[model samples]
Target: MPRARGSGASAAAGGGGAGAGHGGGGRLSGAGPGGQKSARGTALPACLSVSAGCRSSARACREGGGRGLGRAVLPWPPLVASVGAGGGGGTRGWADTESVGKKRCVCLLTGAWLNGVMGRRLGKNKGALNELFSKAAGMLACIIRESAALTRDVLEQHFNDLKGTLKKLLDERLMSLLQEVDAIEQESIKPLDECQKLIEHGVSTADDLLREGESAVHGDVGQQNEKLCIFTKKALHIQLDSLPEVPSLVDVPCLSAQLDDCLLTILKNQIFRHGTVASRPPVQLEEFVEKPGGILVRWCKVDEDFIPQDYRLQYRKGTATHFEDVYIGSETEFVVLHIDPNVDYQFRVCARRDGRQEWSPWSIPQIGSTTLVPHEWTTGLEGYSLSSRRNIALRNDAQSCGVLYSKAPTYFCGQTLTFRIETVGQPDRRDSLGVCVEQQNGCDSLQRDKAVCISTNGAVFVNGKEMTNQLPAVTSGSTVTFDMEVVHLGTSSNEGGNFKLRVTISSNNREVVFDWVLDQCCGSLYFGCSFSYPGWKVLVF
Candidate 1:
């Protein structure tokens, strides 16, 4: 044995320096002697204790501390005094023995249980963390790429519509401007043409006057007088007009576009900066409602000014650090399905606008859980046996249908029971699966009078009455799922009013839905199923 370097006299000076030595859990700092240090700077010796109420096994444990008992073995301490024996003369501690001690027959110590537990737990935690991280990363990548692409497409479509409208508007304005130019041309030309007509008439009148004057000056005495008299009469008949006043032709109508010179440039700059991805998310998580087998996560836009084109929801398990995108769409409320019962989940929402590259910041996370209980097979009879909580097996000896029941009643609305047909001895119409209001401890015929079930064929039986709803036919490998909820309970406790039960069964690409109304109210319902054939295996979740 390697003795402790610190002496026992210092430990005996009353500082809780006892029981400290070389072992798996006994090593302490250089505290004069071995022991657990106290808050007041004093050390106290502590013997090994068991939380599961072990009496004799407590003090005898040397190597093992509180962790080992079932896997136990005890080795005798060597014939040396404890390292902290008072001046090597105090009461003997568990570590020291006067001679080679015998193994305590009452208790055994198979040590290192805590180390094993830590090894397993840490290893599993790391693997789970990696898996969740990888899934979250992949989900985020898909949301980013797909959301951005869809938003881009929608934005382009809207822009295309805007461009069409703009083109039509510009065309209308252009036509109007051209028509104004035509009007100006017509108006100005009419006046100029009238002035030209006046000028022509005046020139003709002046010519007639000159002709009379010339005839009168012919220089002949008798003939000149007579000709001048005729010319004078004709000239007097021609009324003279003053010179016409004409407008300058340089004054002409011109047309120009009304918009800015850099119309395209203005549109480019404005449109480029018109839309924005939200900097801070306007949507805030409202509440989480507990449903039968799911949670309804709801959100709302806090800032009415910031209108988002879409919203995306994300969630994570309570113990998880990373959250994965669960939904992305315009609906503000989404029901997350297939969650384990009673397990806590955290959820958040983000927003994105049209033509935006990124989603808005996530809303503050909210925690939620479902109200349904965990499902397990509680009763199996005759040829029916349970392999696990979710699996059921039917043996070859089963003459009639083997039956199984859930561990407890599931009456919560929206809770669904899903079963898969893994194997079948043979396919027949006799095979049925459904839920009932009663549970039997032994194999018995299905109480069809109070239950609803579906067969391998397309027939459905409701309360002992067969109804052909034309549901899809099932074969060896079909999946069946069913759920029931109370629509309206009886109004009076005396069972005098109407009670409604809404039951839905889905399988083989079709669903059979029916509602039963009676005079009595049913507070709860139990789920079970019976199979007539042998070698058929079913698993439920």
Candidate 2:
């Protein structure tokens, strides 16, 4: 081995070291938290890396010394030991092992004086991530607030416009949606509230601990140990690795809003459609409004003199040839419930005669759709075609790259887009085989100038610039999901909320979450991804 100088740079540069040995201020290898050797301490290993530098950083990293924002796991390994263990670049005839050991010992002593000065700078980035997370939660709250308000205004304005057209009907539906909006806002903000309280309490506690430690340091020696105990216990309880889940768009999804506009428009044209009397059909599926769970269908009589004994409501599922009875009674308004979200359903109504007479004819078929938006991939590149109602994207040309983009009903707050890797044609042909983003569907590759993506090697790139966050690479047959929500609205007053999604990508059960904020404003965002090689099929939802 070469007798490299104890340059202090070799051991502390990275935190992937195996161990550290006796250097300056070095106690036993297994020193306790009190900086004292343990009763059963084992001797430190002799073979240490010669290239290690800056012992203070390395020591801080190993000890997890600093306290800020909150505690977190060391992203990499410890840096104190295993510097030149593999030996410097040279062929070694190990005839004089003792001499080499002696030289390494001398180098350790030379680097010992840098104990406090060097390693303190080690792993300076430890707590930065947690700090950013806390701050981002705050910022995201602001964005959600603005977006929710805008959404409320939009909804209110539409109903208010219809106030004169159908006062009773409009008012009832408007009030229901408004109430629901309030509930959604409250539920979404609940976790944020709890998180805020916890952070504030922690800050106050940390302040108290700091003051107590400072005073104790300056005052009585006997009190220091007690303070340490309190500090250690308190610090250990501040959990990391996860954040409280705040409500987003996907939680407790209900039937999506589907309006039978054609039917409603016809009803609106008839000035005398609503009356106490009945017609051939006896009832009309006149108006329908969206409820959180399903649509509310309302009908009325056509003539004041004619009366019906009772009414009946029936519905048919998507694309079926026959209609099934759902509700049967005299009620004019019925709330359809327990239906699949986002799917199309047909509803019809009729009435029975007054005196044990036969039932009236079925009303015109009214088409209604649910409100809940299912995950889907709408568009893709030339070599890719969408199947399963645009929910799956298949790459037919294995020789070329495949790219796909998600459609509307974009990821709102707390919504997730998942991709099942049904076919891993040739992941080895490309550096990235899974999810990515592009400015628009026009981009041919994920490495575009406006794209934000992670390479298969786990490097993050934004507009071609590499970032500090190193995500995990994807594997074959892995399920890749992207959870996105609105984090900010555009600067303009009328512009819709811009999406800067905080992403967490996981595959094969190894998940790592990191924030990759995309700066684009389109109210809703289109998710895009590109695969370098072909023969890959993705089922998106």
Deviation (Å) of 344 in candidate 2: 10
Model 2 agreement with the true structure over 195-290: per-residue lDDT tens digits: 878777767777877776677567668988887777677667755334555556777444345667797678676644532322134455543433
Task: For each candidate, give its TM-score against the true structure.
Answer: 0.37, 0.29
List lDDT for all candidates, in order.
0.52, 0.46
Worst 10 residues of 2 by lDDT: 70-79
Show model 1 residue runs off by greater than 4 Å. Answer: 1-277, 280-314, 324-343, 349-364, 379-401, 412-426, 441-447, 474-513, 517-520, 533-541
Candidate closest to the true structure, highest lDDT: 1
lDDT of 1 at 133: 36
